[model samples]
Target: MYAVIKTGGKQYRVIAGQKLKIEQIAADIGQQITLNEVLAVGSGEGLVVGTPLVSGASVVAKVVSQGRHDKVRIFKMRRRKHYQKRQGHRQNYTEIQVETVNA
Candidate 1:
């Protein structure tokens, strides 16, 4: 079965044994986390969607790692005004492996 979950202001479709990177969460490697904001659950053509959230549904996952994404560079300049700006950023993320989707 698979589930659609919400975390860190984002939504993701996940299935058991699948690994994905999400916004950094407060957990250590090997720690199990239960995501309760399940929006939908399904297997093949049978799908159940929630009214905002699915009651009593959850997704279990294990934290595998914590890391940052590649840097994104930003630059800005104004002609004749001699103004310029440059910036770069790397977003932090948590890698987790889905263990189960309970609906």
Candidate 2:
């Protein structure tokens, strides 16, 4: 089975036993996290979509680690104006292992 969940202003399709790197959440390593914003669930028979989210359904996960992603360089320049800017950023993320999808 698989599930579509929403978190951190993003949506992700995940299945059990899968390790996912998502936006950082307030949890420690090995913590059990329940994702209640289940947009849809699949059991090999099409899919069950929810209006916003499925009622009484949830996806369980275990926090594996917390870290940051690779740095992304942002460069902006304007020709003949001698205007240029360079920046870099790394977004925080959480590594979670999907344990189950309860529906």
Best by TM-score: 1
TM-score (all chains, Cα) for each model = 0.97, 0.97
For model 1, residues 1-103, the per-residue Cα lDDT tens digits are 9999999999999999999999999999999999999999999999999999999999999999999999999999999999999999999999999999999
List where candidate 1 sits over 4 angstroms from the true fold.
none
User: 1-103, model 2: which lDDT tens digit per residue?
Assistant: 8999999999999999999999999999999999999999998987989998999999999999999999999999999999999999999999999999998
Report, for every candidate in turn, its global Cα lDDT versus the true structure.
0.98, 0.96
Clashes of each: 0, 0
Which residue runs does candidate 2 get wrong by more than 4 Å? none
For model 1 the TM-score comes to 0.97
Compared to the true structure, candidate 2 yields what TM-score? 0.97
* Cα shift from native, residue 19, model 1 (Å): 0.4
